[model samples]
Structure formats: C-alpha cells, structure tokens
Target chain A: MEVKLSLFGFGNVGKTVARVLLEKEAFFRERYGVEFKVVSIADTSGTVWLPEGIDLREALTVKETFGKLSAWTNDYEVYNFTPKEAVQEIDADIVIDVTNDKNAHEWHLTALRDEKAVVTSNKPPLAFHYAELREEAEKRNIPYLFEATVMAGTPIITLLRHGLRGDTVGRIEAVLNATTTFILSEMEKGLDFDDALKEAQKLGIAERDPSGDILGIDAGYKATILHCLAFEPITFDMASVKGIVEVTPGEIERAKAKGKTIRLVATIEEGRIVVGPKEIPKNSPLAVESHENVAVIKTDLLGKLVIKGAGAGLKETASGVVSDIVMAALMMR
Target chain B: MEVKLSLFGFGNVGKTVARVLLEKEAFFRERYGVEFKVVSIADTSGTVWLPEGIDLREALTVKETFGKLSAWTNDYEVYNFTPKEAVQEIDADIVIDVTNDKNAHEWHLTALRDEKAVVTSNKPPLAFHYAELREEAEKRNIPYLFEATVMAGTPIITLLRHGLRGDTVGRIEAVLNATTTFILSEMEKGLDFDDALKEAQKLGIAERDPSGDILGIDAGYKATILHCLAFEPITFDMASVKGIVEVTPGEIERAKAKGKTIRLVATIEEGRIVVGPKEIPKNSPLAVESHENVAVIKTDLLGKLVIKGAGAGLKETASGVVSDIVMAALMMR
Candidate 1:
C-alpha cells in the first residue's frame, strides 16, 4: 500500500517528521508493507506539490539552507499555494498538520471535506474544535488522530482507547507540559523561575514568548484534548487553568522539605478539567523526572495505570505523528 | 458482526472473563458493533457447548453451584467432551485459552489450523513455544494474541509492537511478576520471607506452591514473552534467571536504608534476558507499589517510556483478554 501525505508546517517538528519518514521508509515497507510518500509540503513561505512525491531529502536541505520551501530552485514550488489550497488540491491519502497555525483547523476541515484522513501534532485544532473536526472525519469515515498533542509519543491515547476499551476511567492526573515540568523541576533544584525559564528557552524547550507555557495554556490545551478523548468533547475554555508563575522556589523548597514535589498537574475527572501547580508526593508516579510526562489513569477495572515518557522533543513528537500516519495508512487499507 | 468464542479454562481469570463479557455485552455491541457469544466453555470437569450461544449467566451460576461445567443440570454439558474435542468439533471464531495447561499450545495450534483467531492469558504456551504458535497463526493469517500474558492488563506488548512500530527498542527493564513484588514489598515492611509468602497465599496473590513466583520462574516466563515480542524469539530456557528466595528482610532493610528498593526486575536487551532481584532507587518508576508492574522501555527515538499498572488481578487480566477479542473482531471485519 502506498500512502501519500501532505505536511503543513516546516518547523523543527515537521522537518523531523520528514526525516523520520525518509529514514524509516524501507523499514515501514518491510514491517507494515506500506510505503509513505510526502506528496506536498506547505509552510509559511509557500507550498511544494509533486504528484510523484516531493523529494524529502531535497526539501529538508532546501528549507534548512534557505529557510523557505519556495526558495527551492525546482519549479514545483508555488509561492501562493496556501495550506488550504494544498489540502484542497493535493491528491494525498492523509494530511499531516504539525504547524502552530491557529487556522490549522480550517486546513484539517478542508482535507476532511476532500475525504482525506488528518493526523496532527497541533493541539489548537483539537483543543478548540474536537467535536466539529471529529464529526467531520467520522462522517467521511476517515481518521483524525493527534496522539502527539497530549504527551508526544507516549501512546497514552492509544492505551486509553484500545488497551482499556471496556474499562471505565474514573480520574486522570497528569504532568502534561514539558515546559512547565522542566521549569518546576529546575526550580526544585533551587533555580529561580526566571532562571529556569531562561534555561528552558536556551534549550529550545520553551519559546521566545513563553506565555502559553508559563500561563498553563499549553498544558490546558493538552488537558482539554485528553479530557475530550478520555471522557467528552471539551473546549479549552471549559478547563480551569493555572500555571507555574506563582510557584516560587521557596515554595518548591518547602514542598521538598515535606517530601513532596510541586508539579504543574492536570486533573480530568467527572467532566471537570483542571490544570495547575499541585503538590504531589515525591514518590508518586505523577512526580516524574524533568521534561517527562506521566498520565496516571485510575480505571475501575485495572486500578491506576501510569504512562510516563518523553513529553516533548522534535524526534519524540515526530515519532508520534509518524505512528499516527502509520495507523491511518493501515486503517485506509 | 457476531464473534463466537470458546473459553478453555474455568479458574479465577477465566470466570472473571465470562463475567466481564456478560456484563459488557451490550457495551461491546453498541461500541464495536459486534456481539460476542461464548459458544463453548471447556474446563477440567468437561465441556459445555451450545451452538446458538451459551447462556453465560446460567453457566456461571451452574459452575459456581456445581463446581463443574459437566455437572450443569442441562442438556448442553458433555462429560466426555475434552478440550481437544471442543476445539476440533465446536464452531468458534476465536478460541480464548486462559488455562495453565502445559499443552494449551496444541489447542491454539488446532484453532489456528481451523483458521480461528486465538487470544490467551496463558504464558506457558508463548513462553515455551512462541515461534511455533506465532508461525502457525501467521501462516493461517490468524491472530495469536496474548496481551494478558506478561503484565496482565498493562498493554506493554501492544505498546512495543503497535505503539512503537517503527522505533527501535534499546532495552526493557520490567517488574513483571506480582507475587515476588508483593513478597518483596512485604519483606521491606519487616515481614520474613515465609510470613510474606503466607500473606500472599492468604490474599490469593500466590499459589499454594509458588515455586514459580518465588524462584523467579514466573517473572522469567513474562520476561521471555516480552523479549520475544520486542526483539527476537527466545524460550524460557534460553534466559538467565534468579528468584527472590534469597533476599532476606535484612537485605531489604539495608536497601531501604540506602534509599533503594529490591524488586524482581526482568532485563531484556541485546538478545539477553535476565530476571533477578535488582536494587533500584526507591524513587524510580520501577519501584512501584505492591502487586503493580512497570515496564521501562528505552527506545532509540522516544528515550524511556514507563508503563505501570496492575500486574495481576482477575478483572485486569479479563480486560486485556476482552480487548484482544474486540481487536480480533475488528480485524475480522
């Protein structure tokens, strides 16, 4: 089976996805009996479409050298071909959205309208329009998977949906955001909030304007997505949000003195989603290491199942998106 | 779609599976659009086969009251009908083997030869004959699923196979046996090994003769199964093993004083399988609560992923088996 994919976004995660796909092409074919081809790539600069499949190695080199897809010397690049146009025009089986674009949902809807499956690592589309987008895909009998949205490539969503299918989930306590967890863990090491945030930025773990992460919106988006998937469809606004700004180093020290750790935890239970800095026992599963995410799902049948792993990283997020793409391709077959 | 099932066991896990299936019948039908009819149940006493579908509630009541399917005061019970006869003569789409019968692999082979999918919570079959059983099912294009074999309902196998499909796994450190973990945790709390064994037996966590669990053979079987799934196939005899018989309370206390916990850990890496009591940081993910299992998978792409949950419980194992049944039904569709 040949699966053609159109990726929207050429940032670190998108570029990493292309690299993984290219690197694992033969492995995928031999293991899953499927060949994945990137039919189009659309970024802020422009879109590059090739029905014969875009040269991912060349695209990576072009984007890295020139910082734009349209700068490719090849004639396949089109300056005005927007993401929406790429979704509508490209003859692809699945459309992958790794962009932070607010209007990425529109492209997702357009792709679903064209009866193509959508796989995304972008949380906004799911955190905001889960029901609408999910219904669109369901109506078309297509997949709209975002396994990377919550905890990168940890497979929490798959565990909840497939592994624990008939089990009733009671509560979920999670450390969802890598940025806040990293900051909080650093703060536990006696680093002040400002210094921790600066270190996160230097490591590219946080953005230049880290308001989304510091303010808990990023974790809230993830909480919303998780709540929607595990329970019901919930918009970001429905979640009560709190961040790590108020968690001072003194407070972290105080918590540590009591054998506890202050972590930005997300609690989803009884249709209520809450994201805030909470003090958990240092030995609890929710108190994971720096930058790692953990979801402690309390199910009626299986008790508490903790899934902990890398919550952020270019390769991790790309791994998640590519897995989603593989599942989508298998579903198509 | 209706999926016919033949259950080959009537112990705790098998009975729990029946109860769960009966309770979740409507849920499975409404969710997966498949009605699962348990057509036959073969136990030590005899076999009960109903062509249309066995009345699970009545079967449960009869088994509880009479202690044997053959003792049921109904026309369906057949005293002379062995498990082999049931597998060969009965019409079932999927055969579920939850027995500890050493020759359960033969029934699985027969099921595969008849082109029926196989789901099992039995570890002996896979531990001793993984390649043979797997090849048989693969040749017949049938699913020989054993999600419940290792960590009961933790879904570690699925995580390695499907969740981390394209990623390369580096090493796996797992606390796979609940009996030893419970014993060790009890020993850490000042109980002697014999006292802890008695407590575990009283709590039904360990068998009367728990040589397998205490001698590390149980964990060895699970480790062998995990190794075969994550890497190449290896029987239980190919791995090095050490049980928990020698870990004294003094030793556990010393480890605790050093902020470490003694867990019967299974290490599978570089084609080597080792099961023994390893001292790890008390704060590590592998140092889970009593009766809990944790699998720390170090993948090339995702770094380390830890999955922790109930390692042994009737309901948890039932959940894993039923989920596999659901997946098998979906695949048949």
Candidate 2:
C-alpha cells in the first residue's frame, strides 16, 4: 500500500518528522507494508508540490538551507498555494499538520472533507475544533489521529483510545506541559518565576512568545484534547485553566516543607476539566522530573495506570507523528 | 460484524474475562460496531457448546456454583472434548486462551491453523512457543494477541508493538511480576519470606504452589514475552533467570538502609535477558508498590517510557484479556 502525504508546516517538529520518515522509509515498508511518500509540503512561503512524490531528503535539505520550500529549485513550487490550497489541490492519502498556525484546522477540515486521512501534532485543531474535524473524518471513514498533541510520543492517547477499550475511565490526572513542569522544577530549586522561565526558554524548551505555555493555555489545550478523547467532546473553552505564573519561591519552599512540590497538573473527570498549579506529593507519579510528562488514568476495572516519558522534544514529537502515520497508513490499507 | 469466541479457561482470570465480556456486550456493540459472542467454553470437566451464543451470565453462574462447564443444564455439553477437541470442532472467529494447562498451546495452534484469531492471557503458550504460534497467525493473517500475558492491563505490549512503531527500543527494565514485588514489599515491612508468601496467597495474589512467583519463573515468563515483543524471538529457557528465594531479611533491610529495595527486576537488552533480585532506588519508577508492575523502556528516540499499573488481579487481568479480544475483533473485521 502506498500512503501519500501532504505536510503542513516546515517548523522544527515538521522537519524532524520528515527526517524520521526519510530515515525509516525502508523500515516502514518492511514492518508496516506501506510505502509513504510526501506528495506536497506547505510552508509559510509556499507549497512544494510534487505529484510524483517529493524527495523528502532533498526537500528537508532545501528547507534547512534556505529556510523556505520556494527555494527548492529541484521541485515545482506552487508559490501562491497556502496550506488550504495544498490540501484542496494535492492528491494524497493523508495530510499531516504540524503547524502552530491558528488556521491549521481549516486545512485539516478541508483535507478530511476531501476524504484524506489526517494526522497532526498541532493542538489547536483538536483543542478547539475537535467535533467538526473528528465528525468530518468519521463521516468520510478516514483516520484523524493526533497522538503527539497531548504528550508528544508517549502514547497516552492511543492507550486511552485502544488499550483501555471496554473499560470505564473514572478520571485522569496529568502533567501536560513540559515547559510549565520544567519551570516549576527549577522554581523548586530556589529559582524565581522569571529566572525559571528564562532558563526554560534558553534551553529551547519554551517558545520565544512563551505566554501560551506560561499562561496555562498550552496545558489547557492539552487538557481539552485529553478530555475529549478520554471522555466526551468539548472545546478548549470548556476547560478551567490556571497557570504557574503566580507560583512563588516561598510557595515552593512551603510545599517542600510538607514533602510536596507544586506541579502544573491537569485533572479531567466526569464533568470537570481543570489545569492548574497544584501541590502534590513529591513521590506522586505526576510529580515527574523536568521535561517528563506523566498521566495517571483511573479505570474502574484496571485501577490506576501511570505512564511517564519524555513529553516534548524534536525527536520524541517526530516519533509520535511517524507512529501515527504508520497507524493511519495501516488503517488506510 | 459478529465475532464468535471459544474460551479455553474457567479459572479466575478466565471467569473474569467472561464476566467483562458479558457486561460490556452492549458497550462493545455500540462502540466498536461488533457483536461478540461466546460460542463454546472449555473448562476442566468439559465443553459447554452453544452454537448461537452462550448465555455468559448463566455460564458464569453455572461454573461458580458447580465448578465445571459440564454442569450447565441449560445447553448440551460435550463431555469427552478437551480444549484441543473443542478448538478442532467448534467454529469461532477467535480463540481466547486464559488456561494455565500445559497443553494449551496445542489448542491455540489448532485455532490459528483453522484461521481463527487468538487472544491469550496465558504465558506458557507465548513464552515457550511464540515462534510457532506467531508464525501460524501471521501466515493466516490473523491477530495473535497476548497483551494480558506480560503486565496485565498495562498496555505495555501494545505500546511497544503499535504505539512505538517507528522508534527503536534499546533496552527494557521492568518489575514484571506482581507476586514477587508484593512479597518483597511485605518482606521489607519486617515479615519473613514464608510469611509474605503466605500473605500473598491469602490475598489471592499468589497461587497455592507459589514456586513460579517466588522462584522468579513467573517473572522470567513475562520477561521472555516482553523480550520477544520488544526485541526478538527467544523462549523462556534462553533467558537467564534467578529467583528471589535466596534474598533474606538482612539483605532487604540493608537495601532499605541504602534507600534502595530489592525487586525481582527483568532486564532485557539485545542479547541479554536476565530476571532476578536486584536492588533499585526506592524512588525509581520501577520500584512500584505491592501488586503493581512497571516497565521502563528506553527507546533510541523517546528516552525512557515508564508504564506502571495493576499487573495482577482478576479484574485487571480480565481487562487486559477483553481489550485484546476487542483488538482481535477489530482486526477480524
């Protein structure tokens, strides 16, 4: 089976995903029995459209060398095409969205409407327009997977969706944002909020405009995605989010005095979805180290299942995207 | 799609699986778009044959009350048929092996040869004959699933096989046996090994003949299953195994004094598969509480993925079995 793909966004995560696809092309073919080809890739400048399937290695090198797909002289570049136009015009089996662009969901929906499967690491598409996108894909009988949205490549979403099938999930507690967790851990070590944020940003774990991560919107988006998958469908607005921006050094010391540490935790239950800085026992599974994500799922039958791993990183996020691509391709078969 | 099942066990795990399947019948039908029916169930005494579908609740009640499926008077029973005969005679879309019988693999192979999917919580079948069983199922293009074999209901196998599809696993360190973990934890609390074993047996966490749990054979089986899934094909005999029987109270106390606890840990690398008592930091993710299992998988790309959950218990084991059944059913569809 040949699974052709159109990629949206040529950012770090997108580029890493392309690199992984290229590196694992033969492995994917041998293991999953599917040939994956990037038919088109839409970046900020333009779409590198190749109906014969883009050479992923050359495309990645071109983007890295010139910072734009339009600079690829070896390919026919559609300079006027946006992601929406690329999705509408490209002949592909799947559309992979790794863009942080707010309008990524439009192209995602467009792709699904055209009966193309969708795999995304982008949060907003799922955090806000889950119902529309999910319904469109379901109506078209195509897979719409976003495993990397919540916890990079840790497989929490797949675990909840498939592994725990036939079991009732009671509640979910998670540390969703690695940036907030990293900052909180640094704060526990006596660093002030601003210094901790600066450290995280310096480490490239936080974005230049770190408001989304520091103000709890990123965790809120993840919480919303998890809530929709584990329980019901709800947009990001349904979740109540509180960030770690107000956490003080003194508060960290006070928590330490009680053998506890403050973590930015997301709690999802039957009727409640909350993301906030909560003081938890230092030994709690959710009280993971810096950059690690943990999810504690309480199931009626299986008790609590705790999963912890690297939640965010270029390679880990790409691992998740590639895993989802393999799944989507297998389903396409 | 209607998925017919032939159940080949009636012990605690098997009975719990039947109950879960019965309770979740409506949910499975509505959610998975598949109707699951138990056509024939072979226990110790004989086979309860129901061509249409067994009344699962009634079957459970009969087995619990009479201790044999042959005592079910509501339907005709095959008195002389063993599991082998049952697999050969009865028609089913999948064969669910939850039996501990030494010859269970024979029936499993028969089912696969008959082009029936196989879902098992049994360890010996896979730990001893994984190559033959897996090859048969692969040749038949049917799912031969054993999620419940390693860490019951934890989703570790699925995570390795599907969730981490494109990534390469470098090593695996796990607390695979809940019995040993519970015993060691109890021993750490000042109880003798015999007393701890008796307590575990009293709590139904260990079998009356608890040699498998105490001698590290149970953990070895689980480790072999995981090794085969995560890395390569190797039987239980190929892996080095050492039991916890040699560990003393003094050793446990000394380890505890060092902020470490002795756990029967299974370490699997490329060519090394070792299961025995090892002292690990108490704060380590693999140092889970009593009756809990944890697997720390170090992947080449995703760092270490730690999964911890109830590794043993009737309900948890049944959750794993039913989850595999659902997966096999989806594959059959």
Candidate 3:
C-alpha cells in the first residue's frame, strides 16, 4: 500500500516526525515493507499539498518566506489543499493531528467521527473529548494513537495496554513531571527557587507561564490519561488538582541535608488521583537523574510496572509523534 | 484452530508460562479469542501427552516429586499412548523450548525445523542455530520468538522486530548482564568483590560457577545474538574478551571517588562487538536499578533509543514465552 500521511501540524514535533520518516524511508521499506508519502502539512503558518512528495526543503523555504502556505501561489497546484478541507477529503491512510491546543477546533473531532486514523500529540482533544473520540475510533475500527500526549516515546500506556492488558492494575505512582523535577534538582544544588525557575525557562525547559508545569497541572493531566489507559477510564477535571509550586527551594535544601531529594510525584490510588511533591531518599531510582526525565508505574498481579524516559524534549517528543505515525500506518493497513 | 502447546522442558519458565495461560484461560478467550491447551510435556526423564487436556496441577505435582515426566507411572502409561508415543512425533501448533542449555538439547532444533511455533528463554539454541532455525521457521512460514533469550520481557528484541524495525541502528550500547551488573553495583558500594560474589551466590543471583555472568560469557552470548539482529548475520566468539570477575572492590571505590558507577557495557560500533565493565558518570541511565535491567539503541536517523526492564526472573522471563505463544496463535489464524 502506498501510505499517504496527512500531517496536522508543522511545529517541532510535526516537522521531526516528517524528517525521521523521510530520512529512514529505506529502512522501513527494506525491513518492514512499509512506505509513506508525506502528502500534506497544516499549521497556523498555512497548508501545503505536495501529492507525490512534500519537498521538505522547498516547503520549509516557502513557509519561512511567506509565513504561510496560503501566501505561496504557484503552478504547483497538483494537490493544493486547506487544513479543514484536507481532513474532510484527503485520500490518505492516516490523519496525524499535531495541532496546538484550540478547544473549539472541531475538525479533529469530526475526523475521528468520520473514521480517520488519528495519531496525535495534541492532548486537549483526548483530555477533554476522550470518550467521543475513542468511541468513534472503536466503532469504525480505526486506531487512535496519542503516545506523545502522556510521555514522549515511552511505553507506559502500552506496557499496560499490551503487557498487562487483562490484569487489573490497582495503583499507579510516578515522578511524571520534568520541568518541576528539574527545578527541584537545581534547587538541591543551591539555586534559589526563583533563579531555578528562570534557568529552566532560559533553557526552554519550562513554559513561559510555567503554570501548567510548576502548578503540577501537566503531571496531573498525564496521570489522568495513565489512569484511563491502565484501568477503567474516568473523567476528572483539571481544576480540582493542586500544583507543586507551593514547595520551595528552602524545602529542597532541608531535604538534601537529610540525604533526600524533592520530586513531583503523581499517583492513582484507591480510585483517586493525586499529584504533588515528595521527599525521597538519596539512593532510590528517582534520585538517579536530572533534566527532562520521567518515571511511573502500574501495580497489579504482575507487581509494580515501572517506566522512565525523556519526559519532554524537542527530539524525544518528536520520537513519539513518529511512533504515533508508525502505529497509525499499521492501523490503516 | 485448536492451539496445541508442547513443553520441551517442565522448568521454571516453562511452568510459569503454562501457569499464566491456564490461569487466564477465560481471559485469553475473551480478550484475544484464542485458547491454549497444554498438549505435551517432555524431559530427559520421559515424555507425556494429554490430547484432551493436561491436569496441569497433577503435572506440576508429579514433576516436583520425580524431577521429570519420565518418572510418572500413570503419566508414563498415558505418555506411551498415541499422543505420548509420538513425543517427537506430536504435531503441536507451538512448542515451548525451555530445556537446559546444552544448546537446549536437540529438541529445540527439532522444534524449529518442524515449523512448530517456538518460544524459548534458552539462549543456546538461538545463539548457536539462529540462522538455520530462522530459516526453517521462514520456510515453514511460522513465528519464532525469543524475547526472553535477550532481555526477558524487557522489550529488547520486540523493539527491533517491530517497534524499531524501520530505524537503522548504528550502535547498541547496552548494560546487558544483570548478575554481573548487580555484583559490580555492590562492589562499587564498598562490598568486597569476593564477598559480593558470595552474596550473589547465596541470593541465587549468581550461578554456582558464575562463569557465564562474572566472566561476561552470558552477556557475550546475548551481544552476539543482538549483533545478528541489529547489525548483520554474523557469529563471533565472546570467550576472548576480558570479563568483570577480576575487578576488586577497591577498584570500584576508586572509580566511585572519581564520580563513576560501574556497568557492564556492551557496544557494537562499526560491526565490532565489545562487552566489559565501564565506569559511568554518577548519573547515566546505565547506573540502573537492581539486576536484570538493560538499555539499548537504534542509532540511526532518529538517534539513540533506550529500553529498560527486567532481563531475568522466572515470571518476567515467562512473559516473553506468553508473547511468543500469542504471536504463534496470530500466525495460525
């Protein structure tokens, strides 16, 4: 099958997914007998359709110059397209949704309902509209992959989905945030809390607002997703959760003196979800690393299942997007 | 299709595989819509076949007392029956080759040749007869899985065979041997190397002779197998490499003072395979927790890929056996 990929975003992750597939094309075909055609790119910059191939260099040039594909007008109209129109009518095997969060963008919701194979890093769709999206995907037997949503390139959801699919997972515990963990690690090294936050932001490790990360909302969101996948699915509002911003560098110093480190922990126990900061002993596995690292688990008949990896990174996050595309292709097949 | 599973050895991994399958009989049918029947058992002691269904409890009971199915009188009589008489002749849909490593006896070779789906934790057969066995399975068009052969259920081979199949792996730097890594971790922690070796033996973490692990022979075996899978179809002897058994605790302490932790690193760079202890920075993921943890790569267009999990333990190892059985069933359908 000639795989046609309808990419829904052109951000760092979206671009990386495209590059990896194009760069490793031979490896895929020679080894797995799978191939892909990058037919489209859609983002705020604009939309471009290069049916046979999206000349990545040319596309980058076009987008960079005009700041939008819509501004680029040439005789290259062989497969000209728009974002919403592409989702509706593209003769593609999979529609990869890498769109940034916009609560009102109903294109993806409609695509899922229409049975398009979706591979995404966009969490809003799943976080807010999981039921409707999942129902439609199942009803039509198309795959809905969101590996990048929870943890980039890590197999926590999959470890439970396939590795322990039938077993009843009782509890899940994890250090699921890297920005805050990085902040905490830095604080341990004597950097003041405000300075540590600034350093993380300077390194592009934390968001500008840093509200989602420092407040623990991001970890809480990921934990909610983990809970849905690991056990029975449930809906939880992101508001009721408290973030770890309350914990300061002073607390970190106190803990380091006692041979401990402060880490943001997330858990689903006794049917309730929790996310916060905790003081851990020095020798524990959680104390072993710094920077964009994350680890968590599922407890069951198999014992506590643990997974740790790049919680966030340009490349690591992009890896998940590519993984989602791979899975999407498999589903289309 | 009636799925018949033949046990070539009623050992720990074999029993655990059977046990989980039996325990999850209803689950297997409900979730995957497949059923497994323990149709045969064989060991050096003797062989037995249960055409209808094996009294798994009774089989376990008898095996515990007699050390083999060959020693069970009723099972012996039942053994010589048509199903039993055809110990070598029994046509099974899948064969669990868990025999002790004398290259896991000829039964494994026979199982592979017969085109019966083969899943084994035993390293010898796969290590020595990889090409031939894989050739036979390919000719017969059946699945041959040995996830346990490398990293147990740690997802090592699965990543190559499926997940990372499209990515060209440049180097596979690994901490492959758990026992040796564990011993070294203890040595680095100030335990006398000899005393740590003794402690490992007492804890059943090290083999009686400990040559395979301490001498790096076992990890060498795994590295060879990984090389064949990741690099080219190649065979090389690992005996010539210097092993970790000679490292003293004083040496470990010295390395630690220099901010290093010891890990048995296995590397394949430009077609050469090397396995030995490398002192890592205090924060490398290679400073893994406990025994049986392994990390590896797919060093191509997408960069380094790492996997970590239990590389040993009966239940963890048996999970691979079950994965094989499931894949075999998928192929049969």
Candidate 4:
C-alpha cells in the first residue's frame, strides 16, 4: 500500500524531514511493506501540488535554493494556499505539520476531522489544545503523534505511551529547552549573560527572536504536552513558568560555591507544573551540559527512569518526525 | 474481549505479574478496552489448570505462603506436567514465560508453533535461539516480545524496536548486571571483595550460585539479546565474556585515585560484543549506582541516548512483563 503525505512548512526542520524520507524511501518499502509519496507541500510563500506524487528530491533542491516551494517548476500546480487551506483542501493519507506557527490548531483539527493521520513537530497545537485534538483523533480513530515536539527524536513520548503501560508515574523533572541551557553553561565559565547570549546566537543555537527561548515559554509548552501525554490533560496557561532571563553572575557563583549548578528545569508533579531555574547537585541528571536534554521520571513500579539525549537539532528533529511517519504508516496498515 | 494467558514459573517475578494484573484488571478494561485472565499456571512441582480464569488473588496468597502454584487448591485441576508439555497442551491466547531454566528453548518454539503469542522475561530463549524463535513467530504473525529480558522494565527493547525506526545505531555500552554492580559499589566504599560479596548475598541481590552474574555470563547474555534486537542476529556463544571475579579492592582504589571507577561494562560496537570490568570516568553514564542499569546508545541521527533505571527487582521485572502483555493484547485487537 502507498501512503500519501501532505507536508506543511519548508523551513530547516521541514526540509531535513523531506531529505531523510527520500533517502530512506527504499528501506521503508522493502522492510515495512509500505510506500510513501509526498503529494503536496505548503510553506509561507506558496503551495505545490501534484495529486499523483511530487518529486521529493526536486522539491528539496528547489526549496534549498529558492526558499519556497512555488519556485519549483517540475510540472506541478502552484497556488497561494495558506497552511490551513492546504490542510483542508488537499487529499492525503497523512499530514506532516512542521510549521512553528502558534495558530495551527484549526489546521490540525481540520486534518483530524478529514480522517487523516497527523504527525507534527509543532508544539503549539498540542500544548494549547491537547484535549480537544485528542478527542477529535480518537473520534476518528486516527493517530495524532508528536514525538518531535518534546526532545527531538529521543523517543521519550513513545516510551511513556507504549513501553510503560500499567505503571503509574509520580513526577517528572526535565531540562527541556536547549537555547537557555547553552547560555547557562557559558555563564558558568565566567561569561556574562549578554556575552553568553551572543555566543549562543553566533553558534546558531539561539533563534533570531530569542524571547521564547529565554522566557521559559518553550519549556512550558513542552511541559504541557508531556503532562497531557503522561498523566492528565492540562493547557499551556495552567503552568507557572519562569524563564532564565533573571539569572545573574552572582547567582551562578553562589550555586557553584554550594557545589550545585543552576539549570532551567521543567517540573510536573502532583498536578502542578512549573518551569524555572533551580539549583541542583552538580552531578544530578537535571544538570546536563549545553544543548543536552534530560528527564528523570519517577514511577511507582519501575523506580526512576532517566532519559538523556539531544534536545534539538535539524537532523535530530527530522529523525523524530520521520519515526512518527513510520509509526503512523504501520498503524494505518 | 478477554485474552487468555498461560504463565510458567511461579517465582518472585511471576507472582508479582499476577498480582499486578488482578489489581489493575478494571483499569485495563476501562482504559484500554481489554480484559485478561490467567487460565493456567505451571511451576516445578505441578501445573494448575483453570480453563475458566484462575482466582489471581488466591493464587498470590497461596504462592506467598507455599512458594509454589501446586499448593493452590481452590477449584483447579493439578497435574504433573513439565513446562514444555504444559506450553504445548494448554489452549491459550498468549504465554508468559518467567522460568529461570536456561534450557527452555524447545518450550518457546513449541509455544510459537502452537500459534500463541509469547512474552518472556527469561533471557535464555532470546540469548541463545533468538533467530530461530523470531523466525517462528514471524512465520505465524504472532508477537514474540521479551522486553524484560535485558534491563527489566526499562523500555530499552521497545525503544529500539518501535521508536527509533529510521535511525541507525552505531554502538552501545551498558552496565547490565545488577549483582556485580552492587558488589562493585560496595567495593568502592572500602569493603573487601569477600565482604562485598557477602553483603550482596545478605541483601538478596546475588544468588547462592552467583557464577552467572559474577562471571559476566549474565551481562554477556544481555549483550547477545540486545545485539539481536538492535543490529543483527547472533547467539550467546559469539560474545567474549569475562566476569569481575578477578577485580581486587586495590584495582578499584587505583582507579578511584585517578578519578575513575571500575564497572562491569557490556559493550557492543562494530559487530563485536564483550563483557568485562573496565575503568571509566566517575560521571560517565556507565558509572551507575548499585542495582541500577544504564545503556548509552550512539546513533547516527539522534546522537547518543542514555537510558538509566532499575536493573533488577520483583516489581520492576514484573512491570516489564505486564507492559509486554498490554502490547500483545493491543496487537490482537
């Protein structure tokens, strides 16, 4: 059987996902007994449509050079379709949403209503409207997987969902955001906060608009999504978030003097959610290095399980999206 | 729908599985839309056959007092049947094998041939005959899951099998044996080797015949099983095993003086498997506490992933078995 995929957003993460899918096309077909085709792609500039199947290789090359899918002229129809319009109008078996837009909730709900399996790296829909989206997917018996939303492709979501069945989770403490973690590690080396932020920007670890990364909003979104999946449903507004924007050199030195390190930790325990900078022991799992994410999940039956891996990267995040695509394909079969 | 289960080995892990299943019966049915019943239980002494679901509460009570399923006599037929004979003769939808016997290969093959889904914590079948057993299960389209075989309910098997589908694994270094880990931690605390071994025995962490654990045979078996899951097929005989019996306190102290710790590490890299005592840095993922197991898997796309959790315990091992059971049930549905 063939699974037709409709993709939204052609940015860095989106292009990487396309490249990986094309690279591993033959492996999927031969091993998993399923073939995949990218039928439609929609980005900020325009949309490209080929009902039969778009040439993924050509699409990636065109997007790489021209930064838009509309520039691809390989005998395909192009239109100025917004992501919402593309999701509602395009006919595909699965929809891959990689857009960072905060208002993509209605588009996801539309896809689920159309009976299409949705796999996303975008956290806005899941963080804000998890309960509603889940209800829609469950009503349609379609999958709504967002493995790449939390910790890139580390399989934390899948592990909690499928592997730890029948075990009750007690609490979760995690270092989720990578940008702040990088800045904090730099600060620990005697660099001031502004210089540390500049270094992170030079290294391409921090975004051009680093407000979300520094204000604890990114980690708060992740905490909301994780809480919805692991324990119960909670919206993004319910979390009490505090970012690392207020940390000073004196605080870092004080923590070091006490044999501790300051890490921006996201904690979900006993129906309470908080994201802030906390001082923990130097060797604790939460005190990870720059660009590294770690989560320590306490459970009743299995004790404490610590999962540590890369929190965010282009290829890493793409790998997670591709893994979800494979899972959705298998489930469809 | 109710799924019929036949369990072998009424030991610590087995009884805990039964108790957990009964305690969570309503939860499974209401949440997952499935119910399970233990129809038959077999131990060394005899077999208890209850086609109409055994009383799990009573069975646990009886096993707690007598240490055998043969002593339970509410209203079930007891017969002298070997594990292999019971597996072949019983009409079950799934078979749960927790027996410690290292020669239960024929029994597992027979269960697969009988078209029964097999979930096991026993490593012998997987460590020795993984290729053969997997072939049998694939031929019949049944699930042959052994999640509890390696790390005891930590989700390593499921992560490799279902989660990291599009990623390529490069290497794996793990602390897999809990008994030796406990003894080594004690040795690190200035206790002599003999006193550490005695403490481990007194704490019920090591068996009376601790050759399998102290000699690295246990870790070697786990390495074989992990190899089969992650990379390719290989039997237990292919691994080069060396136990920690030769490690002295002097060596540990020497390593400590150099800011390192001696740990029994099982390594699988570039088609090679070895289990032995190696000196690693103090804060490495492999430097875990007593009774804690950690696996650091290096992948091409996802970078390095470290999973740490309890390696051995009654509840932890049973949680893995129950998780597998839930997976099998979902697959059946």
Q: DockQ values for all predictions?
A: 0.65, 0.77, 0.21, 0.81
**Model 4 lDDT vs. the true structure?**
0.90
Name the candidate that leads on lDDT.
4
Clashing pairs in 4: B215-B243
Q: What TM-score, to 2 decimals, does candidate 4 have?
A: 0.96
How many collisions per candidate? 0, 0, 2, 1
Better of 1 and 2 by TM-score: 2
Q: Itemize residue pairs with steric clashes in candidate 1.
A: none
lDDT of candidate 1 at residue A209, scale 0 to 100: 98
lDDT of 2 at A103: 72
What docking grade applies to model 3? incorrect
Report model 1's interface C-alpha RMSD after superposition on the true interface residues: 1.2
Q: State TM-scores per candidate.
A: 0.94, 0.95, 0.86, 0.96
Models ranked on TM-score: 4, 2, 1, 3
Q: State the fraction of real interface contacts model 3 keeps.
A: 0.03
Model 2 CAPRI quality: medium
lDDT of 4 by residue, A225-252 (tens): 8898788888989999999989999999
Alpha-carbon RMSD, each predicted model:
2.4, 2.0, 4.0, 1.9
Q: In model 4, which runs have C-alpha deviations exceeding 4 angstroms?
A: none
TM-score of chain B alone in model 1: 0.98
The candidate, 1 or 3, that scores higher on TM-score is 1
